[model samples]
Target: MDFVKKLPRTSSGHDTIWVIVDRLTKSAYFMPMREDYKMDMLAILYLNEIVARHGVPISIISDRDSRFTSRFLAVNARGPELVQETTEKISQIKDGLKAARDRQKSDADKRRKPLEFSVVIFSAALHGWYYMVFVTTVGEEYDKVFNHFGYVKCTT
Candidate 1:
């Protein structure tokens, strides 16, 4: 996302073009606004016009533009809730989390397996059973089968 500033004013009082693009898909939104618009206005506009429609992005890359500086965000966009951090401190935290985060994702991918039966797992917990076996048929021929598992046969 970037801004194209100092253009001829439109009849609608819009002179700046807010160029926001999705890097993965190459889709774009060329929003029109005034060059003197405040950061608070811009942030709200971004949330409504961009995030509301597309969803929150994982990250955003910018060109270190003056308008996007942390000072502007800290003062205007995020007041008391957000604590300003030094660049070095931010990088240190990022480096610390990177390895653990990657390992967790890798472990999750390797060990993941789909459930065979959804209802049986839930039902087992509800009934306090260690195991459940569905018996569909019963006869004299199946007597040995029932006896091995210790399941009582029902006539009805």
Candidate 2:
């Protein structure tokens, strides 16, 4: 959560030490780094020290900085076709039905659930139900779970 431009052992204008941390356990990785460290070198260090030594972790949290956000840094930079494939048709069918179901679920939780709205609610529920059944039937047809409710996919 903290970064300093200068360290006592290093020169005044040398590389920054990118600090990563696990807040719950208070463990940290002190990495002496320049932002411009090429992709290959960075991958080597990460695999050797972090992945190899410590093993895969459930999650890693980092600051919103260019070093983390750079397009070149992403391992899977999807091609335009793949990106379009995921967004345009693949996601829309799942998302649209989910939005309707969630609204119905919220409405149903109220003390005065509407009697006349039962047909509307049933149709919405069926859409959600069908999505799950289709995904399961198609053998994990979609990578994402239906009705994830704003869940963000972090593939790291």
| Model 2 per-residue lDDT tens digits across residues 1-156 | 444445545554446676668675778887676655687977786677667866775544556644564555475576886688768876798898999999998787875533321111111333342211231232332335423544232223
Model 1 lDDT at residue 100: 85
Among the numbered candidates, top TM-score falls to 1
TM-score of 2: 0.29
Cα lDDT of model 1 by residue, 1-156, tens digit: 899989999999999999998867789999999998899999999989988987975555567755566566667565333445455678889988998899999999899764443112112224443444434432224445545655544433
The true-versus-predicted C-alpha distance at residue 65 of model 1, in Å, is: 31
Error of 1 at 112 (Å): 65
Worst window of 10 by summed lDDT in candidate 2: 114-123
Candidate 2: which pairs clash? none
What Cα-based lDDT does every candidate model obtain?
A: 0.70, 0.56
